[model samples]
Each structure stands twice: as C-alpha cells, then as structure tokens.
Target: MTMSISVNARAWMAAGLVLVMAQASISFAQNSKDPIPPKAPAYFPSVANQYVVRLNHEVPALRTSKAFSGIEDRLGASIKEVLRPDLVLIERRNKETRTSALVSLRKNREVAYADPNYIFQALKAPNDVDYSKLWGMSNVGAMVSTKRGLKGVDISAERAWERTTGSKNVIVAVIDTGIDFTIPDLAPNAWTNEKELGGVAGVDDDGNGYVDDIHGYDFVNNDGDPTDDQGHGSHCAGTIGARGDDGLGVAG
Candidate 1:
C-alpha cells in the first residue's frame, strides 16, 4: 500500500526535500577560502554596534542514497563552522518547546549574520482602520476648474502643506500600507536620497545604520527595507507631495 499525506503534510515534505537539496548545493560550493570577503565596519558607529544571526536547524534525511552520504558530512561541517562563531546557540530541550539564545557581541566586532533577502518577505498586517480620510474634514470648499467650471475640492492637503512644509522638514514617516513606486507622477519625486542604504542581507552592506533602506525605514520590525504592503503609503505620499496644476489627482 502507498502512504498518502494531506496538503499541509505534503508542503512540509516538500520543504524537507528542498532543504536536502540546498544542503547538497552548499556542500558542492564549499572551498578552502571564504566565498565573501570581510566587510568593512559600518560608517555610522552608533548603528554598527549591533547585529543578528539566524542559524539553520533543518536535519538531513538518513537515507542510504549515495548522493545523500556524499554531501552529508560536508553539510554538517559547514553548519558546525557557522555555529562555531562567537555567539550563543539555543538548543531545544523537548520536541515541542520554545528556546531563546541571546548573544551580545562587542561594539568593535560584527555580531550575527542573517540572510538579507529575508527582509523583503515581511508579512503585511491588515489595517482595516481608515484613519487618514476618517479623521480629516471631507467636504471643504470649491475651486475654479478649467474643465468642469467651479467644483468642490478636498483642500485639506493643500492647507496642511502650507502650514507644515515651510516651517519644518516635515519628514512625514509614512508607516502604513504599501505604495506603488512605479507611477510616473509619483516616481520622479519619490523620496530619492543618496544617503539611503541598500542590501540583500547578511552584513550591513551600506553602513547607513539600516540595511536595504533605499527608500525609508520600517520601524515596525526594524531594519530598513521600508517598501509598503498596503496602499496607504502611496496615498499618504500623494497627500504630501502631489504637484499642483498637474491635471491629475488632487494636489497637496
């Protein structure tokens, strides 16, 4: 008889298979010298004082396949080398239990190493509250329209800009839904700053205090990479920087 598994079980099985394949790949790529060079210290001293590393804990299959045996030892050795760093390892006491290991690194040395690409896979939480439009005044007044004569306009943004833009930098840290960075009107002036940093993961590639924050910082989970998930940041950005007389969306 053939053994069958549910969808969730099948997913777990597929994941386990993929993990084995990855170990095989890593073993084949092993070299006497390091693949990556030692990264320089981050530019900002205060921000470079800390780091986090995540260790892979997946176990390989014990099958008698030649390929499995060929790379198992190499894979185990690589994992051991990774764990041998100056850090704390959290060993689980039971099969179903929680464990935590906090490793405090010196300010002068890099602490933990984590994959940078993982930062792009942040899960977006649902924001059912419409505080932006809800709190502000809806119908304000009228403005002369070239196409449709005099018409009502939501001038809250214009007023807000007039009040706040000139006085302060108005670094409106938009912590909301995602944003569409491709729109033409929104693209040119879309918060492009050379001081921002970018990265795939692992180390502080840019040393700008945060990793992969080419646009803005996400304080929700920390670590730069502030690309939006919901449609709120785009809307908020429009309300703040929408150019006037564009004959498109409402202007700020």
Candidate 2:
C-alpha cells in the first residue's frame, strides 16, 4: 500500500510541474514584443536616356554590325558616342526608361557590363565668414544652432600644428572648377611659374605648349587663365593651403 501511494504522489507532482511550465510560456508570449523591420536603402535615379556599355570583346564594327543593330532595335536604343572599341555610350528611345534599358543591356550575351551614366557633385564644408565656423578642423564640443558638437571629433589641427604648419615646397593642384589665385589668402600660397611670369606676352613659356600659364592652365576654356568661374575649386584650394598665424580669416 505504501509503494502504491508513493508512485501516485510522483505522478501528481510531474503533472503540476508541466502545468506551471505551460502557464509561464503563455505569460512570456503575451509580454514579448514584435521585432522591428530594417529600413530600405535610398534610391537615386540614373541620368535620362544614357547608358555606358562594355562588350566581352572588342566589336570594331559596332556601328555597322547586324547583330548589334538587332539588339539596339529590340531595346529601342542607339549609339550616341564611341568611347572605346569595346565600350560605347548609348541613348535609350523615348519609349524606354533608363532602368529598363540598363536591364536589357545587362541581359545581352555579347555585353560584359552596362550601367547608366550617374552624375557626381563636389563635396565640401560650407564656407563661413568666421574661423570658428570651421568646425571640421577644430571642434570643441560647442553647440551650433540645434546641434551640439562632440569634442575630439575633428582633424586635430591644433596637435598637428605643434609639429609643423605647412611647407611651401609642396604644390597641391586643385583640378575642380578652377582656383581663384587672386584671393588675398590664396594669392600668398599660389604656385607661380617663373618662366611664364617672366616670359613675353602671348608666348608659350618653357615650351609647355600653354601660353602664359603663369599660375595654371584652364583646360575647360583651353586658355592660360585659370580663374575660378565657379567657387568650388577656390574653396578646395583655401581648405588645403590657406595662410596660417597671420591674424587672417581661416587657416587650412
């Protein structure tokens, strides 16, 4: 009789434990929250009607080839410019979009790769009248408008200046829009070609093939005058080589 009672007690305890576990699981499920979904990346549209295509092999007769001509007809695209024997610039017809044309070109067996012509822009910090506004060089955890800056998140120009300010021997060429060397701060550090500076007017000094390129030649206009028509190049030049410790505006 004692042995039978002991077995019945053990079975009762096991049933109770299972019931407790099931209740705990239900409580946890009710308290738990759903997981958050990740955000999708931002999309940038490609340039209209233009695609750059490169072939698996050099197709010298791309302009006149029947196979390429049929592919162009199917996609409603035409060759706009011949960049290379294997690479060419094509324009999609009005009926096709940039994305559709890119997909069609990528599907072609002969084509190695194809992409839309994406535009690019120059990136730089905004130019302010005061030096304190140049936070990228020396951020001191100060608040600006609604944003508070984190200290030590700068280029640490202060520490770098202890070693050396800059050397005049180094010449940095700003290849963007053009540099306005005539600016007061920029004029002092501008690279001057001695041969062109002292050479005769309307003459190609030093036989460099550029006429009177005293500072630098403007390749855009194909002339010696490299004045900054757009402000981007001058801004970049100032950031790279502005005169320091002169009670001036801002140091590079």
Candidate 3:
C-alpha cells in the first residue's frame, strides 16, 4: 500500500509539471504574434498615388542611373523626380549607399508590380488612438485613426512628452513648395528671420541671396510668401509644427 501511494504521488507531481509548462508555452505563442508598434508619435504623412523605391547599392547615381531607367521602362511611368537621401546630420550615409527614386503607377498597375523586388519589408502604421479628437498635444498610449479604422495597438507618445514638448530655438525649415505663414494656428509659431524682416525691404537684407525673406523663400515662384499654392507645403508645415496646446488645429 505504501509503495502504491508513493508512486501515485510522484505521478501527480509529474502531471502538474507538464500542465504548467504547456500553459507557459501557449502564453508565449500568443505574445509572439503581437503587432510591432510604431516609432513616430504622428502618422507618417501620406504619400498619395506615389511609392518611393530604392535601387541596389551596385546601381549608379539617379540622374543617369541604368537601374532608374530600367524601373521606368518596367513601370510604364517615368521617375517624377530624383530624391537625394540627405546625409544624416549626425552620421553621413555610407559612401556606397544609393539614393531612392519616386515612381507613380496607374491605380491598376500598383497591385501588379508589387513583386519581391518592389517590397523589401512590410509597412506598419499605428492605429489605436482617436487622433482626430486627440489634437496630438496629449499623450497617446494607443492612437487609432478614425477615418481609416486601421490598428496600431501598442504605440506610445507619453515618454516623448516627458522629455520635451518642443523648443522655440529650433528652426524646422519646410523646404518643399512653401508654408502658409498666415494660417492662424501656425502664425504664432512661424519661423521668421527677424534679422531679415528688420532690415531694409527690397535689399537682400540678410544677404542670403534672396531679398526680404521675412517668413520663408519660395523656390518654385522665386518669391517670399511661400503661401502654398499647391497646398503641399502647407500640409507639410502643419505636420512639422502646428502650435501645441493652442486649442485650434493638430499639434506638432
């Protein structure tokens, strides 16, 4: 009887151990499938009807690059513009690194050319907060887009706010078309080179080659307004900085 009792006790203990390990494995598997979170606090500004593609480093420079020409031939759409990846301010891109090229495919062709070469890694966007209502000033534990209804469940912006909201000293130049400095929300935070605005009106006050650049210079029109006729510059400016805590539009 004693021997039987001892054997039964050992068997029960072994059975419990197995059950515990099985439960742990199931929990691990569920966690492993969790989505990767987004790194940026704001939505990646949308690139409309456009996809930026990169060539292998072995490819030549963009202007006369054979790879660029070949991609255009394959896509039936010419490269709209050559995009030079800016040398990272803190660390320059590798000398062997090649630049990215922009391409626009007809809506129908977008789906067809998405081959192994076209897509390197899957793109992920955050989707858990009520961004439209959030105003971007408040911390977003999980920001979800109301219009799109996609899901980026684990993104966090609380830690970034803890460190800094922003500083006025920093100048974020909108190098695209131009910014609408007159926009009420942005006007308060617009970057004016007071040094230039303070000087004589038509006389290249700051000697930066453009005259009277009180707000920002426009490369497209050769003017100072940067009023954003195409609306691209204004949209970009709003994303870069839109006056935090102003109770008007989105925050930077």
Candidate 4:
C-alpha cells in the first residue's frame, strides 16, 4: 500500500531509528562475545593468618571443651595457643577461610568476640636501643618484664621531633635533685659554664658569686659542682635532653 508521509515525519522516524541503534550498540558492547573481563579482587593488609577468639565467660576449660573442639573442626581451624581460660588463638591457612571462620565464631552464641591478629608497628620511630621502653614518647603497648601501658597514651614526641628536635642554644635547666652531666647521653647536651671552666679552681669566674661552678652549683651542699647527688636529677635531665639518634642509649 502506498502511503504519503510528510518530510518532517520521515526525518523523525530516521532519528528514532538512530536512537534505537545506539541503545542496541551499547547493550551489545556491555555483553560482547569478546567476554566481559572479571573484576580484580580487592587487596587487604597482610595478617599473621591467625585470629584471636574470646569465648564467653561461661565457657570453661576451652582446650578440652567438646563444643569448642567442634567449632574448631567445623571451621577447619586449629588452636595455635591458649592465651587465657576463655581466650584462644586460631590459625587458618587461607585468608578467605580465616575471614569466614572469624565471621562464624562471632555469630556463635558461646563466643564473646573474634578478631584477626593484626600486626602493629611504629611509624618512623628512632633507632634508639630502648625506644620501645619509652612509653611516654611513643607508646606501642609494649610489655617490659610484666608491665604494659595503654597504647597511644603518649606525648607524641616522635611526631614533635618531625618538626624539630630542639636547639642546643635553648637551655633547659633541670632544677631537680641534681644533674649528672657526666653520662655519655647527657654530656653532649649538658649546659656548661664556660667562664667557670676557664677560671681558677678557687676563684669565681665571671664573678657569678660561685667558685669554679664549671657545670652548675650544688645549692644543697653549697658547692660549685652541680653533679647529681640523688640520681633523680640525672633521670630528669636525660628525659629532657639526652643525645638522640646516637644508637648508644634511649633518645631524649
């Protein structure tokens, strides 16, 4: 049948056809025979392949408990260590398996909580031999002997050092018991009285009304030697300005 169509109608139909073709092209591209590549798996930080599981307080003798053993068997996990009566360390070879087991343990009614054994470390900490023991400077929840402090409860000295370690010109007086200026760590930063150092032993150099006060003055003993008498002053002085990054002792 012959039908008369207006020029505008013909143009509209052509435009509609183009739109349909575009949509079809997009769909084909989305589901192309070339195969849609599988998405890359997400990456996660590495762990110790272990998890710490804390059972309910009611759970007793977790090592021999039948219920706990059953859970371990079912999850294909093994007890690596028994940290406490209700706490255990579980190990799984595969990351996916560990994650799955952790989820299952969390859902168990007998389990109080479960968490992955995470690795912790300080960020750009000093190489001082005893830096780990200095909890006030950079607390990493470390245990010395049997004592441990709460993590992150520190003065952020490491971060502060990133800005400035401090200048020798800025003298900080340790008005405690007394300062032991002879120690290797504290000797470099110890404040010295140059006038007294150059003056005679019995004479008061720089006329400071003190005789031969080379390091400092001992007010208690009324002597020119400021050397520490009780050990407390030396302790305080070391904390204030011990030689840092020297690899000899703890950094100030």
Candidate 5:
C-alpha cells in the first residue's frame, strides 16, 4: 500500500524535538537551587564641611600635670550649659602643644565668624599668617569651600608666567573657588608680596579702592585671597601656571 507523507514532515519532527529539549532544560533548571540575589551596592558616606579651630599655642603643660581633671570638669559643666551636643575637644602636640575645641555652629554663626583676617590674626600675631603657615593657625583647618585639591594653574597663567615667573611683585587674583595654596605644585605661585598689599577684606589699604586685596579678590564673596573652595579655578590656574616639567598631571 502506498503511503502519503507531508512535505514538511522533517521540519515538524525537528521542531517537536527542539520543543522537547527546551522543556526538559527548563524543568531541570527549575529543580535546581534558586540563584542568589545580587548583593546590594555599598553605601558611601557624605562629607560635610565643619569648622576647625587650630590653637596657635602649644598644648598646655597643665594637660599632663594632673590639672586636666579640673579643666575637664569645668569643660563638662560649660558644655552642658552652652556647647553643642556634638562638640569635640582635641589636643595635639608637634613642635608645640596645642588644643582645639570644635563645635558646629549654625549658618548665621558661621557667617559671623568666617572672617579669614580675624582667624589669621588669632593664629598668627604681629605678621599676618602667610598661606604657607595656614596649617599652623588656630581655629583653621580646611575651609568648607577649600576642602578639594588645590586649584591648578591655567595655560594662560602659564604663558603669563613664562613672560614673568611672577614678578615677586605681581599678584594674580583667583576669583573662583578658594585656592589650595598648600599644594606643593602651586605653592610657588601663591602670592607672597604681603608687603606690597594687605589681603582683601572690606578695607582698601593701597588706595586701590578694593579693600584687603592683598593677594587676589574673590568676587564670589567680595573678599581677597581668592583661594578656590571648589577646584575649577585651581584647575584653570594649573593649566595656565602649573610648574611645568614636574612629573604630575598634565602640565600647564
């Protein structure tokens, strides 16, 4: 007897086989243990700008001379009355002993006490503290805006420097974020001619009509010593005036 077979019989047979294989694979997978859920991403803590008070004086001899207990008691009493619950007391000694009492103040208090001049005088008496000496000053740490890496010299400033390594007399005002003058690369560029002009505040000393513009002015805050708080201006400054030939980031 003659048998009639469909032209697509082979295709249909192949499809059935494939479907059976797929179902078997799915069943096997389902019988296996469930995959472990991906671990949650790690959390990064945010940094807040807090005021630091650096005492110019060395640590008091009294701290180790059995007098600390009384001071601590007095401090505890005073703190209960007026200090913030988060206040911190720290003592440090290097070439000199020093103490720092830190308290987080409200925005109004910060504004009232953010005077760099006052902070400078408080830390360095007679001669104003140079940027190089900022680390030594009392009640001074990294300013909120100046916590980032130091501002770099910009290309234009480099060309300016090529023309003049900066006349120990010429002062360039960085008007953006406060400068990180402490950086070794930019240290030389920091304005050092304190004798030429006083730092910018509200008082103009050289009759330049701009007060305290000793180094440069911060148009953002209307003050002098336009150090970068953010680092854009610093980067620009780096491009313009960073010491070239130094094995670091792209040179100016």
Candidate 6:
C-alpha cells in the first residue's frame, strides 16, 4: 500500500512544530540579571559632591553589633542610596575635594576608601516603548508607489520583529545632524537619559562630565537638546528606528 499527505496537512504539521519551539525559546529567555531594582533613595541626591561605593564584600557581613550601621557621616561619607550589595551611592565631602569618586570599602572598616581609578555620579533609568508604522515592514516587496516606481529595496524587518524589535541596552549614535526629539511623532521614541533629565537642567546628572545631555549633545549650539536645526538628522533617525506600525509615523 502507498500513502500520501495533503498540502494542508503538511502545513499543519509544520505549524505545530513551530508553536512548540517558540514556547520553549520563551522559557529559556526568562533570565534574571539584577534580580530586583533597589528601592528609591530616602533623600534627593546631588551628583556633584556625591560618590558611588562598591566594596569587595557586603556591608552587612562586617558589622559587629546591632548598633553598627553601614556608612556614617564621621567616615566623611553619608549613605544616600544602596544600589546593590557591593555598591552604595553616597554623598562625600572633604577639604579641597568637591567632586565624587568610586570607593571600595575594606573588609573591616566602615570608612570609604576612594579609588583613584573609578569615578561616581547620579543614578539613572531608561524606558523602552515603541509605536510606529512602516508599510515596508510586513511586505517590503511591494512598490514604493509614492515615487511612482516599482522597487523592492526591503530587508524583511517584519520577520526579525518576531524575535526582537530593539533593545534599550544598545545605543545607536547617528553621527549626522541632530534629531528633533521635540516632534510629536518622534517624542516617545526619542532617547533621553532618565538620570540627567531627573537632575537640574544645567547640571550633569550621571557625571561623565557632560551636563544636561538628556537627549544628545549639540556641538554646534554648545548646549544640550540636539534638536534638528538641519532636517538631515531627523530624516535619518526616522529611517533608523521610528517605531513600527504606530499608524502615525514610518516604521523604524
């Protein structure tokens, strides 16, 4: 006896296999990095005179009696926030030294031993959300009708979106003209430093030396807010990653 399978039946079998594989991949990708974010700092921080400390060991381990707290004012440092077991952001002050430094505590002493190699500054967070529409996303094989021509200059971005659209962990610096982040359609997609934006407009929040760079730098104007004086950068950004299927702007 001979047996054959229908086209529909074959497709169903393939679909079922794909469904199982996708579920497995999802489970594998559920990784824990930082475990959990630290609670909000009790007091507002000024990065100028503040520092970040990361000890070789945990602060709780060396504490002798119940009365022994972590870092104190007498040690020339005040506990501002605890970033992690080894990392605590603190405020520091001493004669002639106003800027901050990253310190590593010894196994026994509560005093912050500043490291000449590392520097410290304010904490920051970034958000990840996208909403844009690209006609070419689903089917780039279609014509570019606006130009009145048949073109298939497409890279199959829709298929790639199934895995990931983009990640906040990565940064893409478009070294062209500045982007007009103030645009309504582009505002949500704009990259802003959460820490720097949280601080005073004229101050450097993360303390990498640059001040008030919430968006990008403006070498031309010698200020923050790299708004597109020339439309070139704005146009380039729209092509790079404008958010897909938003129904308002082109797909990124």
Best by TM-score: 4
Assess candidate 6 and give its lDDT: 0.45
Candidate 1 lDDT:
0.33
Model 2, span 1-252: residue lDDT tens: 000000010111101001101111000011113322222222433456776666666544756889768756754678776676666677787757666666787898877667765543322222334557667777878889999999878876554443344555555665777776667666777777889899899999789888888878777677788877777777666666665444556556
lDDT of 3 by residue, 121-218 (tens): 22111222222444342332443454433333322333333334455555666666566666764677676777777998778888888877777776
TM-score of each: 0.32, 0.47, 0.42, 0.50, 0.29, 0.41
Q: Summarize candidate 4's per-residue lDDT along 1-252 as a digit string, tens digits.
A: 111100110111101001001111000112112332332222322255676666555234555789767767754578777676666667864557655766776787766666666443323565667767778877888886888878999887765553355654465655667776567777776666788787788998789787877767777677777766677777666666767666656667
Task: Report the alpha-carbon TM-score of model 5 versus the true structure.
Answer: 0.29
Error of 5 at 194 (Å): 3.2
> Which ten contiguous residues of candidate 3 have the minimum total lDDT?
1-10
lDDT of 5 by residue, 128-167 (tens): 1232222321123445365632333212222222222323
Clashes of 6: 8
lDDT of every predicted structure (CA atoms): 0.33, 0.58, 0.40, 0.58, 0.32, 0.45
For 114-215, candidate 1 gives per-residue lDDT tens digits of 211111111211121322231221233322254432223444332333222221222334455544566443454455434443345535566766655555
Clash pairs of candidate 2?
A: none
List runs of model 4 lying over 4 Å from the truth. 1-123
